[model samples]
Target: MNPIVYAIPIFFLMILIEVITTIIRKKDYYRVNDAINSLSTGMLNVTTGVIFKLGIYTLIYNHIALFSFDGNALWVWVLGFLLQDFFYYWNHRKGHEVNILWASHSVHHQSEEYNLTTALRQTSTSFLFSWIFYVPMATLGIPPHIFLTVSLLNLLYQYWVHTRHIPKLGWFEYVLVTPSNHRVHHAKNRKYLDKNYGGVFILWDRLFGTFIEEDENYEAIRYGTLKTLRSWNPVWANFHLYTEMLRDAIKTKSWKDKLTLWFRRTGYRPVDVATPMKMPDIHAYENYNPEASKGLKVYSLFQFAILVLATTVFMTISHNTPYGFNLLWTIVLALNLIGTGWLLEKYTGLIAVEAIRFVLSGATIFVSNGIWINLIPTWAWQFIIVSGAVSLLVLQASGIAKPGSNREGNTVRAAGS
Candidate 1:
């Protein structure tokens, strides 16, 4: 079995344990709403990462046969880990410094809560430039398998660092990426900004002039981007910066300003706009309304549960199956996840959209089983499964399964309120 595939269950189980412990210990920071929001977004990010990785692997196979490089020596693994860390430091540092890279990396920081789930809240778009940072390792002749394994290891190592529950380990903070140092890295506080860009070794940050130790005077870490995502919409969370950049590009009179906005510092407000638009500060609305209506909670949780199941099934199929149908499954799963997230965020016209999805799912299943079963490849069956699951999710999100009375009342309330 692939180590990554094995690691998923273990990772989530660890998160579950942490959640339970947090509850029992009476930590007020364990926010279920935030967890749900983060998990939904994180799952989407992981799906995006998988798609990006597949494309990168294809490129590696065609252009750079790093898979054939010598990796038998123990030193090779050590060197690969160290080299990957060095590159990761730069990749991470640049992610903060550059606008385009920040657009890709910003998803990870969108969560206000610091926990194990936050570690999974990675960027889907990193595949575009991330590979560029690691190419030096490939050119240095690290075998592709070794490089890949070490990269995963480096990522897994960073996972435990993304929590507020874990305090600074005395001497450990000096050499390794600790929760304390990482918290500082995530903080929006001026002093902590763009510091501690290490995957496995904090020493690199110290050496490279990016290290900032946690300071009590700086106050509690304020998570998320300097400019916040005001909504829980996963699509907007992923693409907001890109959209903002595009908007600025179009509105600006100068082509140079357009190009500069894409590459320039994040939050570079252009001058000479007739009126400057103020972005909403989501942090200002941190007060939670009383628990949502019980019926809405149940409905949302049911849809959320379905989304999780569909994501797991998609991941399993993607890992175990061949590339052809896996890509199809991925696209379907991504759409399903996004759709469900949209529903959870209370987007308009969700019910009507999901009803159509249900009809389409039934049609596809019947057609595939009746006529196309014999003609299609075995992997194609997996694609059909993914499609059906996605359609079911869409239907649920659209409120096709919701009680008629509930739908009518919701509509009335929406109209009246």
Candidate 2:
């Protein structure tokens, strides 16, 4: 089954429930714009993985089928689930403990608000290490497709667990990864670090000694990595850990510490350093008081609604069209929305960005429709291209659109220490 196709409607329904629940609880936790941005990046990550996954699966299936073995055992399917979860537990745990893995996993942890959308904040580089964990399953004679399907199912099951709006489910907590358990996974509190490493099942973590239960004494959970990502740049969020590690390795005097920083532990504090850097206490900081400005809240909400609508329209269109053109357009649209939001958030001249995006969109649509090439003269394409370039330059020169006193800006200035 195509998990993406099946997961879309279910995902939106979950989001609806989360939004309604947040409203009833009088909490502004479900920021629709943020969710849309995260989801867009996450989808891009998954799409990037598809090519590698298909290639790997094909190679393994073709090679392994040559062996004289039964691949259709029901027990094999069951074992595939168990084995995949076990490997995932280790992969997830190492993602916290190893800087290299953390580079890929940090995308999920970068979001400060834990909700259904956070589940979509997946790493684009996950495929780099994901295959390593599943190789054991392939050796056990499970067909590649079965292994892939079960792995995806395990991932799909994890989406609901990202939400804080859902509370603890007593017995379900033991058997499966609940919102309560996974909330602990996202928490940066001392007690919650490296806990709850399960995918669909909590048993793996329980058996592996990585599980930590919720503690009321820890206070309300704070989301994000220990080294908080201070930027909203999705590309940087995905690659910052790697860049930091490389820089540290290059600067360090000791070869051992340099190597260890990448392979040994995530965001490791080097003892050999002349000066020790202190990690930020994200939990110590007070939450942004959105209540201070009712007008700003209303404007943010309006922008958020538009973002959600845009995402839905693109996703719906993506589902119906063939993968080639549809996928290309979907990415272009998603990036445009993300770029727009980023410009707005950074207070980086929104009009210029919008104008550039408008020209790009127009050129793409015109070329895609074969209007200039087919309907217009050959000379018109050159004119259209020049016009598009000029439009982009004009847009780039115009700065971001600032909201009036009626608008609360998206800039998140840290509260007093």
Candidate 3:
């Protein structure tokens, strides 16, 4: 009953359409590195969910809540959708207003571009608190299957809103979250900060007095947060806020401040631990895009695409594959993703890590033969090996991997640091 699994093709199709539209319009709304970082973040979330999500379902193992209506199917789903939306509004709003929650949620806002890719840039650790928000549904005896389905639908509804091409829908803007409304939510502009915090419905914001209409004099909406995440690494995007929070917590002398910093309101600064951070000019700031050569871009894209394909395979066939193979494959892919991110960011000496990954790719083939050989056809395996080796050779031939004496010019930061 996983609608998202079935919708993967549609998701990428829409992304493709958006890319084509960008080309037709002669706009640069999408960047290769930014989109790849977002996709990687999303893939990481899916992989981790496979491991940690069981704990959430296990919470309502066998207990029935107050209203376990077996007869009224329509009533259950309608109620489930409404109740879930209510909880989601709070979850999303609190995620913006609270420091600890914002730590995980900040990943979504890291991208300055408002497109389908930005929609996919979700948090890897949102599960820690997100499950708690849905506990009430389980308590109400909402069937898990129905709840999961509605949740998926709820998520699907939000996808189309993450675009710039769509104008504000006339009357529909009053009730549903739309592209216009979501654009305001993603804005770091002073007026739009923390406004319009609903996932599917704008009604919650209007009722709760958290709604703001986008003013054209706010002219162009500048996306992203005041404290910008100046990196392309998806792994860093998730934990950077938490890292900053931990540092602040350690600096404060008060035991209460030390522990409570995480729970405090968003952007709370302790006087004891304060360092003057140069706040970027919100209205006039550049996106955190670093430069890489054309060869490196092509090499990085090929490696990343292979990771995406591997993740897709894992998601589709996880049930058929052994737990060990799934676990091992995910580990290898995650590690590869880290190295790839480093390479994309122009980190030097990672050519050696790339070499190590080639070795690991071969090792994975041998180690996983018993599991995947029986599951997928033999040609698929040959495709993987032949394509991977060819990509590696092409990458080496690209010559950016081995920058020789000019290595410093190509590298943004020293790799493996």
What is each predicted model's overall lDDT from 0 to 1? 0.68, 0.66, 0.78
User: Could you say which candidate leads in TM-score?
Assistant: 3
What tens-digit string does per-residue lDDT give for candidate 2 at 190-275? Answer: 67788998898899888878888887655667777776665545666678888877777888888888868777666674565535
Q: Which residue ranges in model 1 land beyond 4 Å of their true spot?
A: 54-69, 273-291, 319-324, 347-417
User: Tens-digit lDDT track for model 1 on 1-417?
Assistant: 335556777778988888887788777454444566677777776666556564454355447654454568898889989998999999998898888889889888877667888888766677788888877776667777777898889999998887777777999999999999998888765667788989999999989888988876545566666676755566677789888777878888987887787777656646744354455443344432123334444555666666676666666656655554455545555555556554444534666555554444345445544653442346545654675566556556655445442322111010001
Q: Tally clashes: model 3.
A: 1
Question: What does each candidate score in C-alpha RMSD?
Answer: 6.5, 6.0, 4.5
lDDT of 3 by residue, 161-255 (tens): 99887777999999999999998999877777899988888999999999999776545677777897877677788899899888888877989
Off by more than 4 A, model 2: 50-54, 64-72, 253-260, 269-279, 286-334, 366-400, 403-417
Better of 2 and 3 by TM-score: 3
Q: Rank the candidates by lDDT, best first.
A: 3, 1, 2
Predicted model with the maximum lDDT: 3
Better of 1 and 3 by TM-score: 3
RMSD of 2: 6.0
Off by over 4 Å in 3: 55-58, 275-279, 369-385, 402-417
Q: What TM-score, to 2 decimals, does candidate 3 have?
A: 0.89
Give the total clashing residue pairs for model 2.
7
